[model samples]
Target: MNEDTYNEMNQLHESGGAVATVDQLIQTLRDDKNYDRLFDALLLKKRLEMGVPVVRPTSFDNLPEDRRAEFEEHYVNAAREIGSLHLEAGSIPRAWIYLRTIREPEPIVAAINALEISQDVDEELVDIALYQGVAPAKGLEMLLASHGTCNSITVLDQQFMQLEPQVRQECAALLAQTIYRDLTATIKYEVERKQGSAPTEETLRELITGREWLFAEDNYHIDVSHLHAVIRFCRSLDANRDEVRLATELTEYGAQLSPQYRYAGDPPFEDYYTAHHHFFNALTDTDRDAALDYFRDQLAGDAPDSDKQLTAYHLVDLLRRIDRTEDALDIAAKYLLSVEDQLEFSFAELCAETGRYDKLMEVSRAQHDPVGYAAALVEQARTP
Candidate 1:
């Protein structure tokens, strides 16, 4: 790239009876630590070997069919080598440049995946792996491994959820699994240390099933706040997933803690862990009727008006999760339509679902909702 390198390249060209000038130039560039030009030099060498113009953008369509495959194969192999060299030097951004060009991310992704997460994750690699749109799931896994659960949850909540739906779900699942794993390990270690032997499996329920002595002095395992946040994220995971099942056990453990540790939450989760255990079990279809009945009981209490409405919406959501949308519509019409103001649950949408315009109009006039009344009238007219 410098004047001396240019003069040396010309000399190598003059003496190119046996060796190639581009190869000599690449070697010179590598020796001088001039990798920027080394990339161009490598491209030049490939172009010369393939008999393609070296300016830029080698058009595969213009090349002979017999040679195109060979050229492509060589190009991929060369690019992969350079990219791997950069990754070995802890230069993920530089490696990504070539890896992305070749549309082969497996090497870099595997590199990040192979990281011993107990050690520090390369911050630049995390940036490329997650934000730059390559291997996002593994990036999230690394963050969960190297960083603490609290930090991972905060970042996932504040940032990662904005990604595509599938990517967002993957991140959410990772958070749940990581939390379940850490919490399970902590409890397992304590049980093993206290007792002579512990459960060999990863079931949190079995670990704490009869271990009342573990909580005798008002002691706790793992961060209670992390447990709460992780359970909230676990809602996105499939009910039958192992992580969700493990989280269910976590709630069961939390339910048995002392009164001091039992924190009240909003309606439906008013009893926090106890309520969450019911909700999760219903999702997993284990003791399904009992969990559904637990929430139905919440619907009957003469609680505050707003709290009652919250329970209504929560109950509707639960029914909807279990393929009971028709039931959700009925509950929505009964409760959401009678609320003082606009509730989170949409009664209009419920009407649209099952042609329930008749109830919509009834509740609309009772609640003095002109918009609802008009929409229901229009919907009724459009039917049949």
Candidate 2:
């Protein structure tokens, strides 16, 4: 048997409480089917793993009755294994094959169930199965059982609101986990479907206007993209007034849901900045000032240097934007001497942009060792 078949049988047996030796699994596949069926299953599994959709061949219907029955059994068995081993993140290939290769309805139902049980499976694999139109209602129940948590549901409801009310059915919660994955996967799929363009009004509306999740976790992770999609969806629905309100709510809820993952001060600064950029951008001038004041006040207590640098940059930009060039220079100076070359360059550009050429020249010269500083100043003066 091929590695794909070996892996599938292993996962199936493992999930069913009958762990089989790999050699034993291989021997079983070899004796159980025609070489062509075995070859097709392996090929379909590979296609699914590569994220390529595999349409079922009509040839499956043309197989002899006994062979067709063999294929059906293999497909259902594969689906159950996919679901059972999915909790361990090991059943994606088999699951995809069941969806793409198995045409029999019973096997498709089994595949969908497997996907639901294996809630933590790849978003891409789930997406393939969903697009194939296999047992959606049952599949969703399985998704919720494996993935839905208070946090995950919150994200799901947010995305669901973006859909037509008719399409936004509550995910069933039969198993312990709640699968909000349909909406989450839908968001990712739509983004890919649109090739990174902003979502249309129809798509945007599908994403926003819900009080429940407006934020959700897919699989076992709280993806930042989910937050951003919600933010974008809100803005698209009402960029003028709703932007601020939606942003504020998201900020509040994000903090409440994961204080350690605070929307205001998340580290690796860029992501936090991106997540909350709309809130800051949507603020009235006075509101912006008040918000910055709050953020600046928080920075006084053992804040990371990354946060300080981002705060300093924001302050410098705000000051320069309002013609407080001198203040901007002061803010930039606080971080300029300590940051790396890229930020040093940014500060220098800000100084130039704000007509603080004298300060720019000074900082540039002063940045190096005394000898290098003197050499830089001489070079600057010599530039004319």
Candidate 3:
């Protein structure tokens, strides 16, 4: 039978406890003789292992104790058969699954045997440690003894997080002893801490100067607030080359991001806008123009109204910087009409810079903003 049919049969057996589903699976096993019998045996073994209730008019409770014991023996035998078949087929993933169904030390021993033959044991070991209740400390010990690399460290980190708090504390020293200690372990630990738990000063220093900070690629799954905290902490310290370079890269990245980008439970819109401004202000002329082009593209696209407004504001600033005052004033004039209250100060400032006192007075009157009106008046007086 195809994989979809097998999966559907399994799901039907699980949810409805249909005996017919099991019968069909058995019949398919018989008909497709050349197809790996191990797969068919594993399907039935998994169902029994999960304790799917038997669907029949008569219940198992009505059966004698000897009958129940016989059924239990059948399941154990089936699991063993499935394990042997999978091992013969060289399907370690399937073998591990069936082995885990058997009781304690068998699963552990089988996993070790699989590792002996398999070239890569990282994923298999992590799975066993996570699902089979294998001793993670022992797994770490074995991995370390083999002169494991970063993959082994990652496996240990995953297993560490899955461990109970007391067990994790017990294994902490083992993790510390691993030669391949890296940010993966630190990030895992930090992520589990209660939100807003401040990092130690030394931890902050390591995060900024460590390889993770300098060369880590962007990943959306990463907690941005952690990076933000790192940057903020670095700013609090004495300025250093690593800190300055990290800050600059992060700033450029922040600027290039579109206004449409959002995360769940983000900070206030004003904060995001302020960050964009800081990024744009820090860019070199060439990079700033590239950013300006991006903002212009966003303005021309079918962006949300709020995004358009933010883009227009940045576009105006870029134009002003590039000495395209007239273009800036023109965009400011049109943007000011609809967004007068928010853009009044900026529009008035632009007008004064370009000697458009008449336009500044118009904005000041329209918004009834004393600051813009006063600044415009001061510029008007200063004009020869």
Residue 269 CA displacement from its true place in model 2, Å: 6.0
Better of 1 and 2 by TM-score: 1
Q: Note each model's CA RMSD in angstroms.
A: 8.1, 18.8, 21.5
Model 1, position 158, has a per-residue lDDT of 66
TM-score for all predictions? 0.64, 0.32, 0.30
How many backbone clashes are present in model 3? 0
Clashing pairs in 3: none
Task: Go through the candidates in order and give each one's C-alpha lDDT.
Answer: 0.75, 0.47, 0.51
Model 2 whole-model lDDT (C-alpha atoms): 0.47
- List the candidate 3 regions with Cα displacement exceeding 4 Å: 1-223, 228-245, 251-282, 317-325, 358-382
lDDT of each residue in 6-94, candidate 3, tens digit only = 79897878886755666666666746542245344444444454464433311334445545766556656766766665666666566
| lDDT by residue for model 2 (8-99), tens | 77677677633233234434644673333444554344333333344552234434554566655655555444433342344544545543
Error of 1 at 220 (Å): 1.1
Tell me which of candidates 1 and 3 scores higher on lDDT.
1
